[model samples]
Target: MMVRFRPTILRQYLLQGQLPTTGCLRSQARLPCIAARNRGAYLLSYAPVRAIHSESTPTASNGPADPAFVPLRKLLKDEAKKQKLSGKKKKKNANNQVVEGWELTVGIEIHAQLNTAKKLFSGATTSFNDHPNTHVAYFDLAIPGSQPVFQKETLIPALRAALALNCDIQQVSTFDRKHYFHWDQPSGYQITQYYEPFARNGVITLQARDGIAVEDGEGISVGIKQIQMEQDTAKTLAQLDNVHWVDFNRVGVPLIEIITLPEIHHPATAAALVKKVQVLLRAVDACVSGMEAGGLRADVNVSVRRSDDPSAPLGQRTEIKNLSSFKAVEDAIIAERDRQIAVLESGGTIASETRGWSIGSTETRRLRGKEGEVDYRYMPDPDLAPIVIGEDLVQHLRETMGELPDAEVDGLIEDFKLTPKDARSLVGLNSGMGVEYFWNVVDALKHRLGSSSLADNLPCYQLAANWILHEFGKLWFDEHEDDAARDFGFTEDGQCARVPVDHLADILFFLYRSQITSRIAKEILWAVFRGRVPAEYASVRDVIDTEDLWFRELSDAEYAALADEAVKGQESVVRVFMEKQEKYPQGKLMFLVGRMMRLGPEERIDPRSAERVMRERIEERYIPRLRGE
Candidate 1:
C-alpha cells in the first residue's frame, strides 16, 4: 500500500527537493556577448553558436509551461509516427545539379524583415541605424513585470505578402513560443507561428528567362507551403576574443518566414525562386529593404537521390543556413548536393544535418546535427493573443497591392512587343518607375508622330525601351560610379535627375522618323541629359532646331566636290570598285562613302544619302576610266 505511488527517476529528483538540470540545457556554453546596429534591415550579422541536439523528452527544471503548449504534443507525436512510416524522399531532371543518374530536390525558407514602422510587440521604432540596445523596451528584455502588447498593424504587411503569393489566409492564427537557448535571445523562447501559420498553399510560376526552361510550355511553378509572421532575433557578431557581440535593436523586429515546397530541382531555379519572391515582396511594398541590405535571409534545404531505380528513396537532406545573395543560394546548394552524392557513392550514410556556407572556401561545412521538433518545445505564447483580421481588411489590401513583376513582364512582351530581357530590365527600374517611364516615352513618341504606328515597321516601344535601359541606364550607372568627366550626371541631391520622358521620346521620334541621323540623335539626347540645353524644348524637332543639330543635306556643288575628294583620296578603294565592275560594287563603294561622310559637319548627313552620291561619282568617273574608254 505504501509503495503504490513509487516515483520515477526524474520525479524522484524533483520530490527530493532537488531540481534536475534539463539535459539539453545542461550542455549549454553561452559566452558573454555585445550588440551592433546596421542600416536598412534590423539585423546586420549572425554570430556562430553551438546548437543543442537531444533525443530525449524535456523534464521540468523551471516553472510550469502554459497549458496551450501541451496541445501541440500530440501533433508532434503523430508527425513522428508518420515520418517513421514514410521513410524516403524523392526530384527532377535537375540539369547539372546532379550527375546523369542523380536527381536533386531543394526547398527554401526565406526570412524577410517587414517594413513596418514598429517592432512586432513593442512601441520601439524599427529603425536599423539606432544605437545598440537603445531601441529595446522592457518586454524585449523579457522583464518580469512588463508583458508583450500585441501590435495589430504589423499584420498588414504580412497580409500583403500572403495576397501577393495567392496564399489562403487563415481567419485566425495563433503564435507559439519556440524554446531554445542562444546568446542572442534575451528571452529563453522566441514567439513565432509554429502549429497554425497565417497563410498556406500558393504558387509562383517561374519562366525560362529566370534560367529555368518552361517544360513543354507548362511552366515551372514553386509551391508556397506557408507564410508565417514572427519576431526577428538580435543581430549577433561572430565571436571576438571568445565574446559575442549582440545588437538588441533588431530584437523583436517583425519578420515573415515564407516556406516553399521541396519542388525545386536545379540550383538556378532555387535562386530564381528566391529572387522572384524578393520582387513580389518589394512590388507589394511589403519588404523594401533589399537582400544586399540584410533585409532578407534564406535557408536552403537540399537532398539528392539516385535515378537508376525509379522507386529508390532520396538521400537525407542538409539545411544550409543564412544565405543573403542569389549566387550564395545556388553555390551552396551545388556544393551540398555534390557532397551528399560523394558520400552516397563512397558507401557512406548521409546524415541529416545543418550546415553553413563558407564564402572564402566556397563550400559548406557542418554546423550541427539537425534538431527535431520536440527539441524546440513549442509552447503557446501566453502574452500575445492570436492574430485575427476581417474579410474587409483583406479586400482593401488586395485592391491596393500593385501588379506583380512577372505580370508586368508578360504585359510588356504582349502589349508593347518587348523582348523578355528588355521587359525585365524595365520592370527592374526605379522600383517599377522604369516601366511607367517606358510607357510614357512610348505615348510621347506616338503623340509627336500623331500616329500609333511608325513607318517601315519601326518597333516604337521596343526602341524606347532599348534606349531607356541600355543607353540611359549605362549613363545612369556611370553617374554613380567612376564618372570623372561627370558627363550626364545626376542632380545635385544625388538623384538620377532623369531627362524628361518627352525629351527621350523626342530623340526616339527624330531617329525613327529620319529627321536626324542616329549619331546626331544620340548627341542631342546627351545634351538634354547633361542639362546643356538652354531650355526643355517642346519636341525633338525643337531640340534639334534650337541646338543647330538638324540633319542637313549636302548642296549639289558640295556633294560633287566631296565625292571627287573621296574617290581620289582612296585610290585603292576606287581600283577595287572598278575591278569588281559590277553595276554598284556595293561593298568596295563603302570606303568612298565613309571617307565623304568624314568631312567636318558632313557627318550629320545620312549615310544612305552619302552612299548614293559616292556610288554615282564612282559610276560616272572610276568605272568608265577602268574600261579604257
Candidate 2:
C-alpha cells in the first residue's frame, strides 16, 4: 500500500521550506487530519488511509470509521507485515543523500581531571601507576564519620579555563550531592555543583572542517553551558565469571566538568570543540587532557529532527558515554546519527538510552536506559560549605593566567610573519612549551648576533622554527615516547632536560652565519639529544670543533680553479650543454655544476655558489664555442 501525502505540505517539510502554521495542510471532507505539535509549534499534519487487500474487504476497525481517528501503531505494523509478505527489502535512502528530513544536533560534556598533587578533599597522592587503592584516603573511601573538605588548588585551573573560554566567573557557588548507585562510586553519592556552577555563559569558536579538510573562513561557536568542579569516580575492572574489582585510586580525584550547549550539528564540529577544550585545559595547566590515560573523558548527546521544519521537535536522543578519544567522539556521533536516521526511515521510534562506543567495531551499543535529572536526586552537600570566590582571587587568577594558545599563535604570526599553520604548529607544541623554547632560543640567538629583533631577521626566525618543530620535536618524541609522557614527565635518560635553549641557539647562530653546514647543525643537535656534548664546550661551535664537523668553505680563487678543472674533466657534459643549449641548456648546465661540486676540494661548497660559477663558465667560454661566435 502506498501512503500519499499532500505535495505542498510534504514538500515544505521535506525541503525545510517555511509554511503558515494555521493551514499548512488542506482539510479534505473525505480524509481526516491529525495535527502534531513540534517544538512548541503546530507543524505536522498527517492523514492515514486504510490498506485494501485483494482477497479481503477492509473492516471498519481497520479502516477507522471516524475520519480523524487513525491508529498509527496498527498502520505501521500492517505496513511492516505487508512488506515482509511481499519479500521486499526495507527502503533505504542513498548514502550520499542527506536523509531528506533529519538534522543532527550534538552536545558535548567533558570531564577534565585537574592537575593537582593530592586528591580533592584529601591528602592522598593523586599519582598514577600506584598499587590499586593506594591513592585512597579516609575521605576518598567515605569511611565512617568522615567529612568532605574543599581543595583550593582545584579552583585555580578551573577558573583559568573559564577565563580562557571567556566564561563569567561566579562569585558564589554551592556544592550538591548527586545520588546514584554504582560499585565504582563508593560514597553512593557524588559532590557536584548542580544548583550553582562556578562558571557559565561562555562561547568557544572552532574552525569548521569538511570531512578531513578544514574549511577556510568558516567557524562554529558553541556555548559553554557550565563548568563545575567535582570529584572523580573510582576505576572498575570486571574479571571473568562476573568478578569485579574497584580501585579507589581515581576516586575523589579533582575534576572540572565542561558542558556545552546543544549547538553542534556535525561530528567534526564536536571533535574540534573537544580538541580546542583540550588545548585550553593544557594551556591553563588544569588538566593533562590525555584521553588514553583517563585524564580526560567526553560524553556526547546526539539527537536528530526534521531539517525541513525549523520548529520540529527534536527526536529522542541517546547519550554516548565515556568516549575517551576525540576520534571516538566524532565517530560515535556519526555512527549514532546514521543509526537514528535508519530507524526513523524504517518507521521505528528512537529509544532514549545511554550507549557505549565500541572502539573495535566503530559502533555505538546500548549501555543502559536513559536517566533524567530527577533520577539523580540532587541536594546541597552538608559537609562542605558554599565557595565564595572573591574579586581579589578572580583578579589574581586573571592576571596569572599565562599566554593562552590563541594569543600565542597570533603573536607568532604577527611577530615572526609565520603562516597560521606554522604558528599553530609552534604554539601548539608541548602545550605551549615548545613555542616558549623556540622564543628562548631566538632570544639567545639575538643576543649572540647583537641584533635587537629576531622578527626583523626573518631567516633566523624561520630557521629556528624549522629546527624546533622538526629536529627538537623528534628528539623530544624519541625520549618521551608518548604525548602523556612528554606533557607530564620526562624519561630517566635526562637527555631532554640537559639540552638547554642556549645550546640550540648557538647551533642556529652558527648555521645563520654560514660557519657550519646544515648537516653539521643536525649532527650537533643529535649530540645534544644523545648527551654527548661535554660541559667544557660552552657552545655548539665548540662541540663542532671537537667533533671535526666544521666544514670551512674554499676561497673564491680556489673554488674558481676547481670549477675550471671540473669543466675540463667533464668534457662530454660541456659538449652536451653547448649542443643542447636550445633544448636542455639549464639541465645540462646543472649536470656540469654537480660534477664541479663532486670534484672540488674536500671542503664543503654551497650548491648555489657552485651553480652560479658553472653558469658563468658556460656563458664566458662554452656558449661562445657552441654558438660559433
Candidate 3:
C-alpha cells in the first residue's frame, strides 16, 4: 500500500504524475499530502494494480538512518487511507520535510519553588529538612475532603518573577485543577492556572558559545504561555528491597510553573536559557536555592524534522521530564534528537511519549504514555478567588527589582573589566549562593580593598571572581546522592547543606590582599567547613605563615650553628673568598645562602641574621684586604 499527497490545489495533474504508471514517479519516491474538499481540490483514493516488477516503496530520507530500523511504512499508508475515507480534511505542511535547518527556535520555562512562608493552598510551613513527613499538612495529604485555602505570598513572587522576565502581567488570573496520578501527588489533581495565567510573552538573554549574547529573539522567542501557582507533590523513596515510601513533607509546598512554547532548536541554547533563568530567579530570591531538592525543575518539549521542510508539520514531540540541571536538560534534548532522527531513517514512526533523564549515561528512556493537555484535566479552583492585580501593586514590586543576572554580567564585563569566562564562573557560583550571600561577598571585598568602586577595579574583580568560584564556594550534591537507609530527607524539616554566604564573604576577603597562596586559601576554607571560626588565622594561616617567617625569628646562636655547618664542607669557597678578596667572590656568598636555607629546622640559622652577620664579616675582613691590594 502507498500513500501520496498533492502539492497544490490548481495542480490536480500533479497526483497523476505521482502514480507508479508514470515514468516521472520513481518507485523509490514517497510523497506527503492533504486531501482537499472541493471538486478542484486533491483526492485520496487508493487503487492496487499489480506491477510487472516487484519494487520496494521509498521512505523520507534527509540522512542515513540507523541499521536496526523497521520501516513503519504500513502504518502511514493505513492512516492516510483512513483519513481519506472519513471525509476529514487533512492538514499537512506545505513542504514534505519536518526538521528546520537554518533557523532555530528557542524558549525556556523555569519551574521555581516560591519563597513563601506556607504552601499555596495550605498553612503548612515551607522549609527544608532531612526529616520525613514533618512538613506535611492535612491539605497536602489530600485527606478525602480537606478544603484548600489561598495565600497571597505565593502570588506576589510569581508576579515578581513575571515582572523580572518582562512579561505582560494580567490584571486577573484564575487557578485550575491539573490532574495526574502518581505516588508523590496525594491529591489527584494539582491546583494550577489554565484559563488565565498570571503573565505571558516574556524574554530572557543567554551567553552563547561564541561569546555573543543572544536574547530569545524573533524566531527564537521564549513565549511565556503562563505563570501559574501550584503545589508540589511528595517525594518518593524506593529501597533496594522494592519497598516504596512517600515523604509527604514536600507536598503542598508553594511552587510556580512557568510554561514556554516549543521554541528551542539547539541543545546549547536550551542549556544557556535554563541557566540564565535559574540565575535570575536565585538573584531575586524568587526561587529555592537547589535544583535537586526540587527547588527548580523543567520539562523540555522537542521535535525534529528535515531542513527543506519549514512547514513539514514537526515530528511527534517528546517531553523530557525532571531535568534538574542545565547540563542534564541539554543531554536529554541531544538524546531525543538522536532517537527521533534514527526512527525516521529506519522506516519507523517517532512515538509521542514521555521520557526520563538518566544523568549517568545522559540518555532518555521511555517512561509511559504520551503527554497531552487533556491529561491534566485543568479547571478553575472553586475555593480560591480570582487574583486581582492592581497598578499600584505592580509599581510597588517594580521598585524592588534590583540588578538581575543579565544586567550584572554586562556591568561586570564593562565596569570590572572581567573576561567572559571569569564573569560566568562568578555568576554561576553566585547563583548557587543566594542573593544576600553574593552581594555580601562583593560588598565585603570593596571594604577590604578600601575602594568604593572595588567591583570596577580590574585587579579587585579578578581576585573576587576567583575566590567566589573556586576558593570559598564548593557546590554540594548531597541532595542528589542516594541513601540506602530508612529516612527520606527531602522533607520540610530537612536541613539543606548550604555554604553560609556571610561567612563565605569573610573568607574571600581574608584570602584576598593577603600573602596567602591559592593552596593556603583552600586550607582556610577547609578549616571553615569543619566549624572552626572562618576568621581564625592561627588554624590555617599559621601553618604557612609560620613556615615563611621561620628565618626572621632566628637568634645569634641559631645563626652561628647553621653557618658553622654550611662552611665546614665547602672550605674551598671560604679560601677563594679570602684570596680573591680581591672582590669577595659572588658564588661564595650564594653558596652560604643556599647552605643556610637547606639546613633542617634544628640546624638551620635564621635567614635575616645569617645574611647580616655574613655581610658584617665580609665588610670587616674581605673588603678591607681587597681594597689594600
lDDT of 2 by residue, 1-629 (tens): 13344544443442344454775434532222212233323232333222111123334433322134445456556766877887975432213223456788888899999888877788788966654554567788677888887877778878888898889999899999999976667689999998899999999876532222142236767899999998999876543333344566788888889999998876777887887888888878878547767799999999998798989777789999998777678778878898998888889998989999855233589989998889998999988888899989989988988778878877887888887777877776766677777777777777888888755677887898988777766766674355543442222222135466777788888888887877778878777655576655656767877767776787667667777887785667777766663466777777777777778743478767777877777768776876788
- By the TM-score metric, which is better: model 2 or model 3? 2
Kindly report which residue stretches of model 3 are placed more than 4 angstroms away from their true locations once superposed. Answer: 1-109, 209-221, 430-457, 473-629
Model-by-model lDDT, in order? 0.73, 0.72, 0.61
Error of 3 at 68 (Å): 36
In what order do the candidates fall by TM-score, top score first?
A: 2, 1, 3
TM-score of each: 0.73, 0.74, 0.61
Residue 159, candidate 3: Cα error in Å is 1.5
True-vs-predicted CA distance for residue 495, candidate 2, Å: 12
Point out where model 1 deviates above 4 Å.
Answer: 1-95, 129-134, 213-218, 237-244, 452-458, 479-496, 514-547, 553-603, 607-629
Best by TM-score: 2
State the RMSD for candidate 2: 21.3
